[model samples]
Target: MTRPPAKAPAKTLAPVVLIDLAVLLLAGGGLAWLVLRAQATLPYHWDWSVLPQFLAYTAEDGSWRAGRILTGVAATVRLSLWAGALALVIGTCAGLMRVSQRLFWRLCGGAYVLFVRNTPPLVLIFLFSYFLSGQLISTLGLDAAVAGLPEAQRPLAEALFGPLRQMPGFLTAILTLALIEGAYMAEIVRAGVQSVEQGQWDAAYALGFSRRQTLIRVVLPQAFRRMLPPLTGQFVSTVKDSAIVSVISIPELTFQAQELVSATYRSFEVWTLVLVLYLALNLPCSLAARWLELRLQRSDRGA
Candidate 1:
């Protein structure tokens, strides 16, 4: 047993390392070429320095504070957070309805999915903004209540819901995002729930579990493990789709970027920064999903 001529670690890794380095170099070269080509024809001067001011600035007292871009990012994150939460709730319910034994519940879920999935998201945003949200706010007297809040409490309301003037718009955006994303989320949930072995249901029933108990205790847990990856993906999609609300002037990231571009005349730089900001926002969700998936896989193997 001569150790098979001592397998060299460097020899084994060299090809992979070389390939990775080659890819990086090619990407860098392509980016450089594109930049050079753009700079040649585009007369606008790049001013990356101004971007930081929009993202953060030092006040007169020298205290650092978030600037317009940072504010916009916050708004975007806030919108996505609320929208994602609501979407989950709506989607889970709709998905349950989709898989319900009752014909009426299934039909209701099916109709909702069909209508929302078939309609354009932008159109939904507008209709909800104008008709549904407006009526709800008026019926609920939300605007009046917000307006009448004590001066001290007004800031709290603004912080929670956005500028009082735009509260309706913000709520509208959230509803639209939830309804639209919920349609897709329902399908994901339905599929995940359905993917479980039918024997699992039989086993739960054999254990004298009621349907609801079986679903809540036995089915959903496993389905949830299966659903985590796609749920994370839908949340990421929610973040990106939140940008569309900018068209209705919600002052989210894209809206703020547009404002910055108009004022700074730095379309390329502003958009590039905005693009990076979005990637920064979404990349963590993607990574976390993968980590969770791996953890689940390990747990399954261990069991």
Candidate 2:
């Protein structure tokens, strides 16, 4: 027999559609009210037209180049990539340790997560950047070593990290972000690892795989597949968290926005543009994470 028309889905969405429209109308009205209030009571001038010019422009030689805002966007992207990579490594190791048989490993992982998650990030950044960073960098001579590099090689280092003189402070910023983000990531990893059934571990052991081999060859592969959604979401957090690093003079997007505001006094315009820029970077990652989660749900049902 032929199937009936699928009107039930539309019927189900009728209230949802109405609710969504209601929400949009309310938001629009609120924004309109704010604009009216700003015009009447506030000294702020809305000059959105001038904002786009800051994003990109032609250089003196007529070649296309990133402007102040775009340069900051690039810096933010670079910071997120480096910090996210390190956080993933730190988190994965800590996560594995959390599930380890040894008390020492477990304690170490717990302490890292507890300390990082509980402490205020600003305080931690100050300590790490001003005090600990100097001591550590001095011990390693990382900044001094980079500063002394020949002029020809300096640009490459700058491209990878930042200016040679600032690399030490920048490194500390990267480390602070990584260590803070890693605490949250560690929980994600721990949950992913724990989600794997005990039976899988037993099966691997019964097959004569060593503990390391069992985790690496069997459990982690399965756990990692499950972890993909949260991992993507965590990277979005990393992108947003990169903003605060600007306080340490990393010149990321927020820093650039602040500088533009200082120069132009276009406070609302600059901040609104920055908000949109951040959403542009984050929204895709959020959507992709949702898609991955949905796909995983479908696969589980099929299995």
> Whose lDDT is greatest here?
1
Q: Tens digit of lDDT per residue, candidate 2, span 100-167?
A: 99999999999999999999988887778787476988898886798689989988888988666777
Candidate maximizing TM-score: 1
Please write out the lDDT profile of model 1 over residues 122-184, one tens digit for every residue: 998888888756698889887787778899988887888788888877888888889899999
Q: Per the 3 Å backbone cut-off, how many clashing residue pairs does candidate 1 have?
A: 0
For each candidate, the alpha-carbon lDDT, in order, equals: 0.91, 0.88
How high a TM-score does candidate 1 get? 0.91
Provide backbone clash counts, one per model.
0, 0
Weakest 10 consecutive residues, lDDT, candidate 1? 1-10
Cα lDDT for residue 4, model 1? 62
